[model samples]
Target chain A: MSTTTPPRPRRSRAERYRSALWLLTKRDLRVRYSTSALGYFWSILDPLVMSGIYWFVFVVVLDKGGDIGEKPYIVFLIAALLPWMWFTGTISDSTRAFLREAKLVRSTSIPRTIWVARLVLSKGLEFLASIPVLIIFAVIFGAQANWNLVWTYPLAIILQAILVLGLGLIVAPLVVFFRDLERAVKLILRFLFYASPIVYSTLDIPAAIQPWAALNPLTGIFALYRSGLYPEQLMVFPIVMSAVISVLVLGIGLLVFRRYERAVLKEI
Target chain B: MTEPIISVTDLGIHFRRNKARRRSFKDLFAGSARRSRPGEFWAFRNLSFDVAPGEAIGVVGRNGQGKSTLLKLVAGVILPDEGRVRVNAGVAPLIEITGGFVSDLSVRDNVYLTAGLHGMTKAEVAARFDEIIAFAEIEDFVDTPYKHLSSGMKVRIAFSVIAQLDEPVILVDEVLAVGDKAFREKCYGRIDELLSAGRTLFFVSHNERDLRRFCSRGIYLDKGKLVLDGPIADVLDRYNADYNNPTP
Candidate 1:
């Protein structure tokens, strides 16, 4: 019953999906960096400049030297901002995941989730590359580091990746349906920047509002990053809340994506 | 005698009058966004057809009659709103503007990325890399970004990649209609080789000589309905008569 077909080995669906995902992630990174000779340096420039501005405003100008962070406040500021940039960048790009790539989105046979997941991976890599900036800052500022960093840093990365991937899957498809939601997401990110514990530690939040603040998943992620240098910033309650919320967001994201995928395809 | 490799049953897709406009939040509250019934009409409804394995089918139609939409449905890119398009084999769609590449990627990366997107392994793409590049006649621009390429060059790359695909069902939607005369001839020759090897083709084009060269069976479409389906010469005759005798 068989006609003579090509003898090439048929790869499993998962294998093909994985390879396609990696190939696309590589493309994103190359496109963002390959054209610029100082890609890595320029990529980290935004967070570095932001840290400096905050340091100048709070530490130098206001003379609140001890209030901002531990000695060499720049390390503390850079630690939280790097991951924040990763979070916001992925979510922002997610708005256009289907719209910007409509042609390929409608053409390729690859699983659609790869489109969202690739953004998380590429942005995560950029965040990872900027970690050395924190390290060199730590050495220069002499920020205290505990042996617990070995586990906490990587744990935070895994959590952030899951969180962003879930949010992206949810955002990318929904924006295809509601184009205005793209601008809505931008507004939310702006609020989230001040709302998240990037400029200040979670410990600094008023005791009355701390419980409500724990609802923000990032309160815990930032704690994990900061806990590497300042042990007091790590709180078990918010960290546990973040873990639960990250997993929950991912579950909801998958459902939202599956429900609206067809409509998204049509809309795009 | 064999089962049809592709089956379309009561297939329909709809378009809204204001499909270009996203529903406002007020529409969401008013519940108008939830209903799929209003301000919409089927582009093609209750359509049924099938293609047998290794069958080379020509789909001839005037502009905007749903030919390209049919190929999109078969390729599983656009979901059918009513019935379904069932194909037993993998579909390799030779479409434009979707070489399955990020526009910023280099030609070399795009070649690998696109082929991989369709399930071609790295080793397989590696083996055909030089062949694809040489066929496209763009060895000099291997490292250049895809967005910088001329439209003709884009078509060349798309064809080169799709031609290397092992997928049994190939959808060619006027892909050969573009590019210069010499390159188009080269593309036609490649298609001829593939057809001789028994690949299933769904070729759509307005060019009669080109259609006749590739297809033994033709289906003529007008007003989003199948007007005639028969031997190539007969279908071509009906198409011409309809063209000459326009509706008032």
Candidate 2:
């Protein structure tokens, strides 16, 4: 039942997971970039193209562009849209995190949570890399930097990271057990694209609907992001709501992940 | 008589068929009742064993007889259905030849990454990097992407990385099949070196001669049951007789 010999000191669970998380994250980043010729350029290109299309269609073609505010509609759209791309991209990819590396999951004894964490970390790195693009747009649009911008950016980044971790933790294991969750997750994210305030500001919604819309954690997150670009439109309600909801989702996601972690290997 | 470095009590593992999974869109939308339940079957059942330090164990069985399952249970990759497996020492599992290799990463990168996953620190992997590459004899291709390597080169790289891992127990499942004759000889030499250094080994091989070469004791499993367990010669004799003269 026990060893009389002096065993090598075992690393704590947190330490082991931390190391594995780092290595896997590195591997994911290297593999992703090495496959394509353009490499990291592809990360910025996705949001740039997407924002350009939305800007042209909404501002040039549709009448909604004039209502966005003093800043160019492109600037406003990039501020909100870049973070949305990161949040949605991380969540969707993480749904297949475990399933993608079925052999690695079955072969290694590293904590299974590292798979989902790798996806989050790698995508987060991409999101961070894309921030310079956002800053360039803001400078061109003549948006003035303020003291509030410094804290708000990190705050939004940390909150969105936490929210993605929690959701990914839940989705990664759940999709392994229920394969259809992979498809269902994509569908839900597509619907959520319109549901969140990605294109237009949340203020444009009716006052009756604004409170209901604020219930979405992303509404608060996007509000935080948008507030950085257009401080005049900043609302504290969504930021506070996002903070509360992120913690709740993190707690629930951890519970779901732990419950299903052991069962996942057998199912896969 | 000594305490086992690895012990299994009432160990069992069962797998459910894919039919039991809610894989269809209709199944998710319509709920659980519409999906057919997958039948469950045990891979191994009611098995118990204890492996002493420095013992080399040969796990022999026919295909689909849970030979690999037992190794997986010991390595802690899969959970046992009803019972426990307690490993009191570090384990290195060679279940897949390219288990953790990223195709786009260079061989040098994979060596560090794979070694780190097995609990080696960055400094440790760096110290042994040259030794692993030399042992694998692919130092020329160390900077090449893993996908670019031929299948044989990949195996050599993977085996070299794992061979340098300093674990108390090593679980090998038929990785010898991948290597060339020269590499297999190197692997045999490595096994001899490991045994001499007092490492515990559990080798699962279908080749009887390969098992006899490395193992002093043999465990024969038949249809998830412990058919025989004893000295290598006796267990092999019984196994060979059973196979040569089948019961109707």
> Quick one: best TM-score, which candidate?
1
- Listing every candidate in turn, what is its Cα RMSD in Å to the true structure after a full C-alpha superposition? 3.4, 4.2
Instruction: Write candidate 1's Cα lDDT for A55-166 as tens digits.
Output: 9988989987687555567888999999999999999999999888888888876788999999999999999999999998999889989988999999999999989999
lDDT of each residue in B1-248, candidate 2, tens digit only: 88999998998777665546454535434543312345667777888888999999999777888999899888888877678999988888888858788887889998999989988889878878898998988889989988999999888988877777868898999988877898999888887877777889999997888788889889888877888889987887888787774323
Task: Indicate the worst ten consecutive residues by lDDT in candidate 2 chain A.
Answer: A1-10
Best by lDDT: 1
Error of model 2, residue A212, in angstroms: 1.6
TM-scores for all candidates: the values are 0.90, 0.89
Whole-model lDDT for model 2 versus the true structure? Answer: 0.82
In candidate 2 the C-alpha lDDT for residue B200 amounts to: 94
**CA lDDT of every candidate:** 0.84, 0.82
Deviation of model 1 at B55, angstroms:
0.9
lDDT of 1 by residue, B1-248 (tens): 79999999998887676777676666533643335657776667778888888889898888878888888888888777789989888777897535476677789988988888888888888988998899899999999989999988988988888887867888998877779999999988888877877889998988888788999888887776777878888888888787874323
Residue B103 in model 1: shift from native, Å? 5.4
